[model samples]
Target: MSLTANLMKTGDAKDGAGSEFLAFTLGSEEYGIDILKVQEIRGYEAVTRIANAPEFIKGVINLRGIIIPVVDMRIKFNLGTPTYDQFTVVIILNIGGRIMGMVVDSVSDVTTLSPDQIKPAPEMGSAFNSDYMIGLGTIDERMLILVDIDKLMSSGEMGLIDKMAA
Candidate 1:
């Protein structure tokens, strides 16, 4: 099965549950992830840098004795280097049973989106592709770029963190 087919299945499942999104800001654009995947949100803290890791991997952090790999979403999305400030937040997510943290500019609010309100991601030509985007969620006049966290951090990619731990 292709990634698009898998995403279509996911979209079908989501259509029945009436999903909620945890919205956040990356620069001026708004992004969201399934609220069910979010574990917690914490203020940004300095991370212990890991040697020989990918550039997008910001390093690891000790969260309640668990070592979680942190990825800077701003850089991962090719937005730019993030500026640490009051609005900075680390969104802890449980993806495929692995806990990882993602740094974002700031968290907005959780909003509910019915299946009818969600639209397929637009085809955009760029280095950062839209495959990771599950759909486009709209509430009122705001748009949320809903992300598929599992696709964003696939098993193969997560294996790197496990390897580092070993």
Candidate 2:
């Protein structure tokens, strides 16, 4: 069967095989994650600091009885200094049965992109890993760095969730 026909069977298919991404801002660049993985978006909140954890792992928050680790994207992406203001928000994600929160500069709109609008991320050196990159998506004049949220969360650096299997 063709890609369009396969997408139509899924029921949520858009004009010819398209995917939805939740776009957010980090510094001057915009990034997107699979919409299905996002649980909710909330204003940045205080988290209980964890001792000896990586600086990127800001801390944990009690999210309706369940504690969830919150990661700062600025630190993870090596985006220099980060500042929190009225626009800062935390994106709660449910990836591979694990729940966590990602702190971003601001939340943008959800964008739908067809296959024609996506391009593979070019291979960078060891200092830059593109393992979690889905591709670069174009919407009008805007370019979004698409991310694979599941792989990012399960990466060895974010060890809390993966530690459970050990």
Relative to the true structure, how large is the alpha-carbon lDDT of every model?
0.83, 0.82
Candidate 1, residues 1-166, lDDT tens digits: the string is 1422333344445545688778899989999898778877889999998999877788999999999899899988889778999989998889878899999999877667888889999998985579889989988898999988888888366568766645
The C-alpha local distance difference test score for the whole of candidate 1 amounts to 0.83
TM-score of 1: 0.86
* Candidate 2 off by > 4 Å: 1-16, 161-166
Per-residue C-alpha lDDT of model 2 across residues 1-166, encoded as one tens digit per residue: 2422432354464754788888899999999998878877888988788877788888888899888889999888888788999989998888877888999999877778998999998787644469989899998999999988888887888876344222
Model 1 steric clash pairs: none
Model 2 clash tally? 0
**How do the predictions measure up, each by TM-score?**
0.86, 0.86
Clashes of 1: 0
Query: For this target, which candidate reaches the highest lDDT against the unseen true structure?
Result: 1
lDDT of 2 at 83: 91
